[model samples]
Target: MLDLAYDLPAPKVIRGALHDWELVIGLEVHAQVSSKAKLFSGASTRFGAEPNSNVAFVDAGMPGMLPVINEGCVALAVKTGLGLKAQINLRSAFDRKNYFYPDLPQGYQISQLYHPIVGEGEVIVDMAPGVARRVRIERIHLEQDAGKSIHDMDPHMSFVDLNRTGVALMEIVSRPDIRGPEEAAAYVGKLRQILRYLGTCDGNMQNGNMRADVNVSVCRPGDYEKYQESQDFRHLGTRCEIKNMNSMRFIQQAIDVEARRQIAILEDGGSVVQETRLYDPDKGETRSMRSKEEAHDYRYFPDPDLLPLEIEQGFVDEIAASLPELPDEKKARFVTEFGLTEYDASVLTADVTNAAYFEEVARGRDGKLAANWVINELFGRLKKDDRAITDSPVSAGQLGKIVGLISSDAISGKIGKDLFEIVYTEGGDPEEIVEARGMKQVTDTSAIEAAVDEIIAANPAQVEKAKQNPKLAGWFVGQVMKATGGKANPKAVNEIVAAKLG
Candidate 1:
């Protein structure tokens, strides 16, 4: 029932020599499963370890070693499938995808082919306000990751790091529904966010923990509409694949360049070749890696060593029950329950840690005030210091306490900010910082009035101007604030200033 009418841009028709060209894109996103052990071995799945230090005999594929499926990895996979709203295949099996790579210790990689763990899902990617495109998910399969190939170790020699070998990965395959490069990147991002929320993946792109393979092709404009109506893929053009994109910016660039390249080739009375391509970030163009390989080329077959995976409905239900609130649902709750604006809620709930911190600060306190401070003041300072919420100088408890003081008029906004600085820098109770620095609000009406009178007398011309133009009353407010040494409650100061001006 989620409205997707606003999410997609109107399709633009393309005219090429053969037909009006439409780009058909699918994606295969690889997300490393969050687990301490490798998929088939007890070897540590730690990153940045010394080369081969974390490898076990099984990971190295020594003689007489048998593969064992990690139960934790399976659980994580189910959690991910549920998060994607995918159908969990209770009887998924593993197959060997035969391939040759310097880093693959095993001659054949174990992957899901015949039956995948997840099936038929959809991701709603919001590109702009009131506009979202639903990218259909074909399948998500669990597989063992191969080791990394480091070609830069030496000019002549390529070194293989087996530490990452047999690490579990969730290969999420999307249908060819994405129309443009930006949509592809957005789809990947939303997938990453969902996986992270499900606790299945860390969603880290830099450490090779996550990556996307973009499949792009172009056909005539009306062709896509025809394909949508009939569900015929041939209605679109033959697509080529771009492999292992880690950066979002590069993803967009790759799609744009590839689309244009295909368009130009067809325009020049040439045919577009279906191939695996690599994006050169420096040159901002895609170069051919090799001719696209069909599924038969991999020689996929059932693995003789491992048995098919099966799980009980109870297990899946348990994972679902334990799931945390997802980003979209949490954003909505932040707006409804916390009385926060949609923008504020979205910003706070972008990350789990930030959302948790905000919730803790909002508990039993003014939601709007806590949201304002967290988003504007605290988050702004965190950005300036390049610190994450987990590493914040001020704890959620401390922030809540500080806001409480401000709410009760125990401290003026200026004094509260000063106290916040002291607490952030010195690491102490908010009340103690206020007490030690004499940073309480001047709530006494008599004291505030006397300060206001002095300010009005000193700024007589400004007061005269204020009497004529009510908008100019802010000038007197500023004077009163300055006269009271910024200790007077800002709300009370405004009222006193207005009365004096009148």
Candidate 2:
């Protein structure tokens, strides 16, 4: 078993009129499976298709159209379970969660409630350097997504787009281990990163590929500990479900506002009511949507259309073996193998594409130097241009060459920056450009000593000041570098300058 223990940070306390309160948050993240087809239909799961173009007979709930489960979605769900380190139930069943909505053409959603596909996993959220919180996974159930209802296009009528109908979603439910708004956002982010790395979900919140329903409740400081000591809900106050929060910023904002609202209610001598609510970003408040539904409310029953799903141990083993190195494992390897700070490793490994790019650039080069160039120089430039790593002008091979040049003392650090700019704009080999442009560092002792001697002789008064204060020696080194157009080897320039000044 993985060590999921870490020091929990101080709870985010909300000062109420009557009593101070602490936030307890849990997230139900709905991640669309990265499959081309829908869960139980043959329709294409493309996002921007014409309305109803992607709908199948079964998806429309047409008469006598029995649902046939898609094998690909099941495989992806199992893959997600393995990625989360969750238990994959060999025999899991699907049930119909009966609900009525205009977008839900079937009048019900096929989801797992009793026998979830995955069970009992934990997510270790890295809150800070050496500080982590273990958020337990209650279950991950496979379900079909409802079609979208577009209301704003017309004032008098609404339109339904069935592009997302019957789309497979893995409802990743977490235990209420999150104590604050920021941690809530971080937990979702970490979960999204893991999902993206697993190739099971795209984790694109904007595209509606992923979204979270946050369960927020407020309690007194010691109440949370009491709830933890004994598995009881009385200690943890009634939680309101904030529905369909896509943005991380909004997720945090909603939690804070909701917690404060709950505190305000309790202070006013009213008990909190459990309900489903929607977060209005513009108003920065949550409004009640409906009373929170329980299992009996949903009228959940086993789906007669589909049988119980059973998989062999070999099947699960195959997926586990095929699993790529996850974010946490990759981050740990980067810190140990490359001697990187945990912060740097975390930044690099936050995205799978960025991590791959870093690995390629650091393959044979000095890992620390490569990381510095990639993070500071390359990433900074990319950000300035409003570009992603994939759209970066400098390729990994080009960056690796630049780092190699600096590592081998073929070019000074300053010269390397200039080379990076030239390659980023014009595009060429780093070494060939250095040679063609005469950008190689002046490492020869004779040339460097001559330059240093000239600087010291020209600035006798400054040299005396440098001899008095050792820090003043940097002026002469700067002069030497300027004289050589920043091509002088910095180490060699410093050595010569110090000797001549002394």
Candidate 3:
């Protein structure tokens, strides 16, 4: 339950020749559960194994090999449900979804159709600072992933790799609550962050650990409200499912293109047909793959090989207790506790590793100063080098000490940059480096006064000009800092310079 019922303007609307239209989006996100073994067999779920090497006999659909459920996978699904604030069905059953493909060795995907493990949750998508929309969760079902079919490996013959066969997946289906392309992307990002925070899934789209099937449709504005009140889906129009979208940019692009395509057909006095489609990013359009299939088309039936999955209320409570603090909770805490702006908190809490690093650096320290150093200095440097927070050369403890030195005026900001560079390259103590290299700020008023006096004496005309125009007083401050070998405390120098000039 996100408080996103408040009215907000729709950002994406197609101004068709006949009328205006808005996009409706729903996502069926597939996330690979983080476990050491496959869903039904103990085959290694590790990535990048030799082709077909990680296959178990059951995963390969060998004759007489019966599938057994992995207990850890079940726990992960339950944990994810609790994290999403959804209802957990203590007794849920699995069904066989009949399909045929080269990647599917068993010619069917074992999924939950009649009853899913999780239901009726909502995700609060941060569209902008202090602006959000809630996307309701329809269901989450656990299923086995198919193997990979490589067509380019050999031109004469296609190759199949069973390494990913029988891997566990949580298909999180969202209600068609999204109103725009950007909202759709934001919704996906929010789910990915929650999954990663819960440790249920890694959410690595590049490696195919998580992907989304975007269902895009178009309808008029008031029609959506009518459907909302009546709970009728026809007002939303025919939704085409865009399959296997891994890139967020591509998701947005596909939704826009697909919506316009549907609008064109409707405007031409032709009815829109529901179907499965593929987005070609190169061509910037969606091509029809096949007619959309209903649940009956899959011929779903209770999986006879496995019994109905039944767990006690105590088991559900146990997994619920083990759930981690999700993204929204963490982001709120970061803002209140650290005095960080919503945007800063959002950036810091975008990933689990970044949030942990920021916390370690900001603990018991000036939160604002720590945030500046972590975001502006450390993160800037890491981004420059194209490295991740986990690959940071400056450890959390080291970065914390550097911020401490700057806050205490033990070192000026310039000297802090120097110290950071030294630690980043050679790796050493921040305080020790400041002391060893004489990077400490010259807080002694007399020493700074003497430098100011010398600089004034050397440039009499310039001192007179500075006194005439107070704005030029900073010139004397810079000169004094240089005379002190860039060690003068800037605030003290400004004070003493103004006094001497007056």
lDDT (tens digit, per residue) of candidate 3 on 148-238: 9999978899999989999999999998888888888888999999999999999999999999999998988788888889989999998
- Report the lDDT tens digits of candidate 1 across residue range 1-502: 2233644434434465556556678899999999999888888999998998989887887888899999999999988888888899899999999999888877889999889989988898877644678888999999999888989979999898888889999999998888877787888888887777777899999998999998888877677878879999887777889999998889888888898889989788888888999999898889999999888999999998999898999999998899888887887788889898777887887788889999998998889999999999899999999998889999999999999998899987777788788878989989877777777788898898998888777777877788888998887777777776788888888888777777
Report lDDT per candidate.
0.86, 0.92, 0.90
- Top model by lDDT, which number? 2
Model 3, runs deviating above 4 Å = 1-11
lDDT order of candidates, top first: 2, 3, 1
Which residue pairs in candidate 2 collide?
A: none
Compare candidates 1 and 3 on lDDT and give the better one: 3
Q: Against the hidden true structure, what lDDT does model 1 obtain?
A: 0.86
Would you estimate the TM-scores of all the predictions?
Answer: 0.94, 0.97, 0.97
Model 3 poorest 10 in a row by lDDT: 1-10
Q: Alpha-carbon error at 3 in model 1, in Å?
A: 7.3
Score residue 319 of candidate 3 by CA lDDT: 85
> What stretches of model 1 exceed 4 Å from their correct place?
1-21, 458-462
What TM-score does prediction 2 earn? 0.97
Could you tell me which residue pairs clash in candidate 3?
none
